[model samples]
Structures are given as C-alpha cells and as structure tokens.
Target: MKINANEIKVGMLIEYKDDLWEILKTQHVKPGKGGAFCQVEMKSINKNTKLNERFRSNDSIEKASIENIEFNYLYDDEINYYFINQKNFEQVEVKKDIIGEKGKLLKENLNVDLIFHEDKAIGIELPNQVQFKIKSTDVALKGQTVSSSYKPAILENDIKIQVPPFIESGDEILVDTRTIEYIKKV
Candidate 1:
C-alpha cells in the first residue's frame, strides 16, 4: 500500500529503487529556510547495503508486503541456527549472520517470528524482553542506592549489561533484547 513519506517509521519495510528496504532510523527535519522533510536510513533486505534518503510529506512510498511466520527455536551448531515452523513443523536452518547478536538470546523452545519475503527468510524478531539468569556480578557497595547507579554484569548467555547494584549472581532478570538492557528482577 502507498503511504505518505512522513508516515514511515523505523522497522517498516518499504520498496525503494525496485528493492526491499527496512527502515533503520528516521528523523524529521524542518529547516528554517526550506521545506520540512523526513530523513530516513534503510538497510537492503536482499543484500548488505544501506541507503539514506530524504522525502517531503507529500511524497508517497510503496510499503513492501512481507510474510511473518512463527518459528520455534531448536538449536544451533556454532555455524547455523535451526528453527521449526510452528504451523507445518518443517525445519529451517538460518545463517548466524542473519540472526545477528540476537542469536545469543535464543533458547530451546522459544517462539520467534521469522520474516519472509518471496519465500526466503530475511530476518528474525526476538521477544521484546527475555528472562536470563545473571551469571556473575559484583556485590553492591554499602551505600549504593538502586536509583543511584548501575553495575556491569554478565548473563548466562555471556552477554554483558548494566544492572542495578542490588542484582547479584543467580538472579533471573528481564532484559530488553533489542537494547540489551536490564528491565527488572523476575
């Protein structure tokens, strides 16, 4: 469907120059001497490429049609990650690069969305927040308050993030997968 350029948002897939692109970031600029425009940063879905473009509010852009399917995480063997279709039970192997750093959060039996374009998996979306056990962290100092500061900690998956001083080893906490930040104790 066609939509105004100003309507575009981060994470929306659109077709540009006959190729599918995923919006990575967008900024609306209103120049003091010129017309307002939206500055967009997009990544190519078919290849490793990036594009930056500017568009006025009056410009219209094509939104790419994509298929989203639920897949259950199975396991990975260092090279490729495996997933099973939740609907048909068919197994699919995806490259490690496509999963990116989010692969570290993948656990057995976790359900995630696999984005497909033209029957090919282009990307995977992990749960917004994941529960992980704190592998290790330093104990809170005597005078530290929860609101005052954050301490670096490692998770069971080996991903390091800042956590409240009160957090310690073996504590299960909710983490925002996209930002890799601590949410709260769980």
Candidate 2:
C-alpha cells in the first residue's frame, strides 16, 4: 500500500529502494527557507544497515505488508529459541540474534507476536511490560527520604534495573520491557 511520507511512524515497515526498512525515528522539519520534509531514521531488515532519508510530504512510499502471528515462547537451548503457534500447534525455531536483547525478558509460556513478511519471520514483539522477581537489592536507608531515588537491583533474569528505594529482593514487580524501568509492584 502507498502511504504519504508524513504518515510514517516508528516501528513501521516500508519498502525503499527495493529493500525493506523499519522506521526507527522520524522528525518533521520545516526550515525557514525550504519546504517541509520528514527526516527518517530507518534500519534495513535484510542487510542490517542504518540509513537516514528525507522525504517530502507529497512523496508517497510503499508500505510493506506484514502479518502478526501469536506464538507462545517455549524454551531455548543456548543456540535456538522455540515457539509454538497458538492457532495451529506448529513449532518454529528462531535464532537468538533474532530475539535480540529482549530475549532475556522472555519466560516460559509467554505470549509474543512474531512479525512475518512473506511468511518469513522478520522480528518478534514482546509485551510492553513483564513481571519479574527481584533477585537482590540494597535495603532502603533510614534517613534517605530527603529525595526520591532509585536503587539498582538484579532481576531473576540477571538484568540490572533501577527501582524505587522501597523495592527489595523477592518482590515481584512489573517492568517496562522497552526501557527496562520499573512500572509498579505486582
């Protein structure tokens, strides 16, 4: 489908120069002397390369058709991660690199969306927030209430994140997967 340049948004997959690109960021610029244009930062899906391009508002771009399939994450064997399709019970193995850093947030039976382009898995999308148990953290100080401060803590996944001072080990809390920030106690 063709879309106006101004309609581009982060996370959208589009075709440019015969290659698929994922939009990472976009900025609409209207300089004092020139016509308005959109500055976009995109990553090549096939080549794994980054690019910056400018498109006028009147320019139309091809938006790639993508399909989202719900899959339940099963397990990983240090080499490949496995997922089972919820609708058909079919299983697929995906490389660790395809899951990226967010793979650490994945727990057994967690549901995620697998993005497909032409029946090939292009990427995986995790939930916005996930619940995790704090592994270890320092106790709140007796008189440290003067200012709001966050303390570093390790999660069950061994990922370090800053949480409110009152949070302690063994507490279950919701964390924003994208930013790795504490959302609230669960």
Candidate 3:
C-alpha cells in the first residue's frame, strides 16, 4: 500500500529502487524557506547497505507487503536460529546475521513475529517488553540522587542496559526489547 512520506516511521519496511528498505531513522523537518519534508535513513534488507534520502511531505511511497507469522523460539546452532509454530508444530530456520545482536534476547518459548518478504524470512520482532534479571551493576553512592541518574548494568542474557540507581544485582526488571532499555522493576 502507498503511504504519505509524513507517515513514515522508524523500523517500517518500504520498497524503493527495486529493493526492500528498512527505515532506520526518520525526521520530519519544516524549514523556514521550503516546504516540509521527511528525511529518512534506510538500510537495504538484502544487501545490508544504508542510504539517506528525503521525501516531500506530499509524496507517497510504496510500503512493502510482508507476511508476519507467529513462532515460538526453540533453539540455535552456530549459524541459524530455529523456531517452531505453536499451532502446527512446524519448524523454521533463520540465519544468524538476520537477527544479529538481538539473538541474545531470545529465551526458551518466547513468542516472536517473523517477517517474511516473498516467502523469505527477513527479520524477527520480539515482544515489546520482556523480563530479565540483572547480572551485575555498580553500587549507587550515598549522596547520589535518584531522580535522573541511570547506571550501567548487565542482564542475565549478558546484554548491557542502564538501570535506575536503586537497582542492583539479581533484581528482576522489565526491559523494552525495541530500545533495549529498562522499563520497570518486575
């Protein structure tokens, strides 16, 4: 389907120049002299390359039609991660590069949406919020205020995230998978 440039958002996949492009960043700017435009940074899903482009607010772009299938995480090997459909118990394998660092967030039986283009798995989307335990974090000093300070911490999955001053090792917290940021104590 076609969408106005102003409607573009980060993480949306759109077709342009014969390739599927994932929007990495988008900024709607209205300059003093010219009309408003959407500045977009895109990454090619197939070639793994990046591009920056601008679109007029009135312009329209073709949004890629993708298939989203619900799957439960099973396991992974050296190169691929495996998932199984809950309803049919069918299994599928997706490449490691497709998921990259996000693979660390995968745990047993976590339900995720697999994005397919032309019947090929291009990406996987994790749930918005997932629970994890803090593996380790620095001790907050006595004089430190709790209002705006955030401290670096590591999760049991070994992913680094920032947590509030009150958080400590072994604390369970909810994390936002999209931004990999701490949401709240569980």
Candidate 4:
C-alpha cells in the first residue's frame, strides 16, 4: 500500500530502492523557512544496511503489506527457533539472527506474532510483558533509601535488568519485553 510520508512510523516495514526496510526512527520537521519533511532512519531487512532519508510531507511511499501469524514457541537449536501453529499443527523455523536478544525470552507454549512478508517469516512480536523470576540481586542497604534507585538483577533466563531497590532474589516480576525492564512484582 502507498502511504504518505506523514503516516510513516517507527517499526513499520516499507519497500524502497528494491529492498525491504524497517523504520528505526522518524521525525517530522517543520522548519521556519521550508516545507515540512519526514526524516526517517531505516534498516534494510534484506541487506542489513541502514539509510537515512528525508521525504516531503506529501510524498508517498510503498508500505510493505505484511502478515502477522500467531505461533506457539516450540524450541531452539542454537541456530534457529521453531514455532508451531496450534490449530493446524504446522511447524515453522526462523533464524536466530532475526530474533536477536529477544530469542532468550521464548518459553515453551508461549504465543508470539510472527511477521511475514512475501510469505516468508521476517520477524516476531513478543508479548509486551512476561513473567520472570529474579535469579539474583544485590542486597539493598537500609540506610541508603533513595526512592528512584534501581538495582541490577539477573532473571531466570540469565538476562540482566535493573529493578526496584526492594526487589529480591527468587521474587517473580513482570518484565517489559520491548525494553527488557522490570514492570512490577507478580
């Protein structure tokens, strides 16, 4: 679908210069002396290259028509992650690089939205929040009571994150998958 540059948003996929690109960031600028333009930084999904481009506000760009399919986490073999469609019992495998750090959060039976373009899996969208147990954390000192202070802690998956000073080891907490930060105690 063709969309005005003004409609572009971060995380959107678009086709430009014969390559699929993922929008990393966008900024709409209305300078005092010139017409408005949308500044965008996009990374090529096919070539893994990045480009910074600006478009006139009225310009149209081809937005990639993508599909999101729900799949349950099956397992990984260090190189790829496997998922299954519960309804059809169909299995699909996606490369580990495409998932990057988020691959560590996958758990058995966890549901995810797999992004596909041209019938090929391109990426995944994990739940915004997931439950994790704090594997370890530094003991909070009673005298150093800073309200905004956070302590570094490790989760059961071995990913480290900062949490409230009061959080302790073995406590279950909700974590934001997008930012990989602590949300609240569960």
Candidate 5:
C-alpha cells in the first residue's frame, strides 16, 4: 500500500528499500516561506537502526503489509520457539530475533500474535499483560516502607523482574513487559 507522507504516524510499519521500518515519530512542517514537508524518524525492524528522513508533502511510500495471526505457543529449545497455527494446526519455529523481548514473558501453551510480512515471521506480540509468580525474593519488611521502590524477583521461567517493596516470594503479579512495570498484585 502506497501512502502520502502526511499519512504516516507513530507505530506504523512501512516498507522501504526492501526493509521493514517502524515509524517512531513524525512531524509535518509548512514553513512560512517554504514548501511543506514531513520529517520522520524510523527504526529498522531487523537491523535495529534508527534514522531520520525528510519527504516532500506529496511524496508516496510503500506501507509494509503485516498480518497478525493468533498462534498457540508450543515450546522452545533455547534457540527457537515453536508455535502452532490455530487455524490450521501447523507449527512454525520463530527465530530469537522475531521473539525479541517478549521471549521473557512467553509461557508454554500461551497464545500470541505472530506478525508476518510476505509469509515471513517478523515479530511476536505477546499478551498485553502476563501473570507471573515470584519464585525467589527477600521477605518484605513490615516497616521498611520505601517511596515506590522495586526489588528484584525471579519468576517460574527464571526471568528476573523488579517488583514493588510489598511483593514477596510466592506472590503473583501482573507485569507489563513492554514497559517492564509492575501493574498490580495478582
């Protein structure tokens, strides 16, 4: 899909130079005495490169076609993750890069959205929030109140995350992996 420069927005995926780029920021300027143009900041999907580009107002660009399909997480072998296509029951192995940070929150049998471009897996979108139990953590102090401080805790999968001072071992909490913030006690 070809779109005008003015149509780009943050989080939109675009295809340029045979590579996928995500729009990180965009600004449209119509100077008092100059032609209108758009300034865009984009991050390469695979290479993790960030770049800035300016385009004339009327310029057109190809928008990458991304398909999001729900798949059931089957397993992982320390190198690749296996997912089963819910619609067809066919399993696919997604590389580590595609899983990215979401790999920390993934649990076996969990469902996730497999993002693909031209039938190639590009990203894995985990659930907005996941509940994880703290496998190990120091005892919470009764009167040692801190100002919104977080302590390190280990989860069942051995993923380490910071939790509130009130959290203790054996407690479950919902975490927003995208922001690495503790949402609520579960």
Candidate 6:
C-alpha cells in the first residue's frame, strides 16, 4: 500500500530503498517562512540501526503489509520462542531478539498477537496490560497513602515491577508492558 509521509505513524512498517524500516518518530513541519515538509526517524529492521531523513509534503512511500493473527504461546528455549497457530495449530519459532523481553510475560496457552509478513513471523505484540500478583515485597507502612512512595516488588511470574506505597506482598495489580508502568490495583 502507498502512503504519504505526512500520514506516517510511530509503529507503521514502511519499505524504503529495498529494506524494511519501522517508523520510530515523525513530524510534519511548516516553517514560518518556508514550505511544509515531513521529517521521519526510522529504525532498520534488518540492521537494527536508526536513520533520519526528510521528505517533501507530497512524497509517497510504500507501506509494508503485515498480518496480525492470534497465536498461542508454547514455550521458549535458549535461542528462540515458540508459538502455535490457533487456527491450524501449526508451530512457529521466532528469534529471541525479535521478541526480547516480551517473552517474559508468555505463559503456556496464552493467546498473543503475532505479526507476519507473508509467512514469516516478524514480531510479537503482547497485551498492553497483564495481571500479576505480588510474590514478595515489604509490608505497607501504616498511614501511607497510595501515592506516598513506590516499592519494588516481584510478580508471581518473577517480573519486577514497582507498586504503590500501600501495595504489599500478595497484592494483585495491573501492569502496563508497553511502558513497564503500574496501571492500577487489580
């Protein structure tokens, strides 16, 4: 699909110069005394390097097509993580680098979004927020409000997250993975 530079977004994948790049940032600038233009920051999917370039207001770019499908998390070894296609139950393995820390949240049978370009798995997008129980943390001090101070706590999955001052061991909370921030008490 063809898209204008002005319409680029942070997470959109685009093809340029025979390579795939993910849009990291974009800005449409119209100088006070100059014509309008669009500036973009991109990260190369293959090389893992960032590139900054500018385009005219009307420049067109190729938008890479990706399909997001439901996949069930299976397991992970040292080098790769595995998922099963829910529709046909076909197994797929994606490199650890592609999934990064997101693999930490995967539990057996959990459904997740897998991004595919044609038949090749390119990325995995986990849910925005996941519910986890605090496994270990100091007891909440008396008279402390929720906003008083944050204490580090470990979730049931062994993921480290900061919780509100009033949160103690065994408390359930919602965690925002995209920003690695605490959302609310669960």
- Please name the candidate that would achieve the greatest lDDT relative to the true structure: 3
Q: Is candidate 1 or candidate 3 better by lDDT?
A: 3
List where candidate 5 sits over 4 angstroms from the true fold: 146-149
lDDT tens digits, residue span 157-182, model 2:
99999988889899999999889899
TM-score of each candidate structure, all chains considered together: 0.85, 0.90, 0.79, 0.90, 0.89, 0.90
Q: What is the C-alpha lDDT of each candidate?
A: 0.91, 0.92, 0.94, 0.94, 0.87, 0.86
- Alpha-carbon error at 25 in model 4, in Å? 2.2
Best to worst by lDDT, what's the order? 3, 4, 2, 1, 5, 6
Q: 12 in model 4: Cα distance from truth in Å?
A: 1.4
Model 4 poorest ten-residue lDDT run: 141-150
Question: Which tens-of-lDDT digit does each residue in 3-108 have in candidate 1?
Answer: 9999999999998998999999999988998788999999997786999999997899999888989999999997999999878989999888887878999989
TM-score result, candidate 1: 0.85
How good is model 3 by TM-score? Answer: 0.79
True-vs-predicted CA distance for residue 103, candidate 3, Å: 1.8
Q: Give the clashing pairs for model 2.
A: none
Query: What would the per-residue lDDT of candidate 3 be over residues 1-186, giving only the tens digit for each residue?
Result: 999999999989999999999999999999999899999999999999999999999998999999999999999999999999999998999999999888999988899999999889999989999999999999998989889899999999899999999999999999998899989998
Candidate 4 lands at a TM-score of 0.90
Q: Write one digit per residue (lDDT tens) for candidate 4, span 110-141.
A: 99999999999999999999999999999998
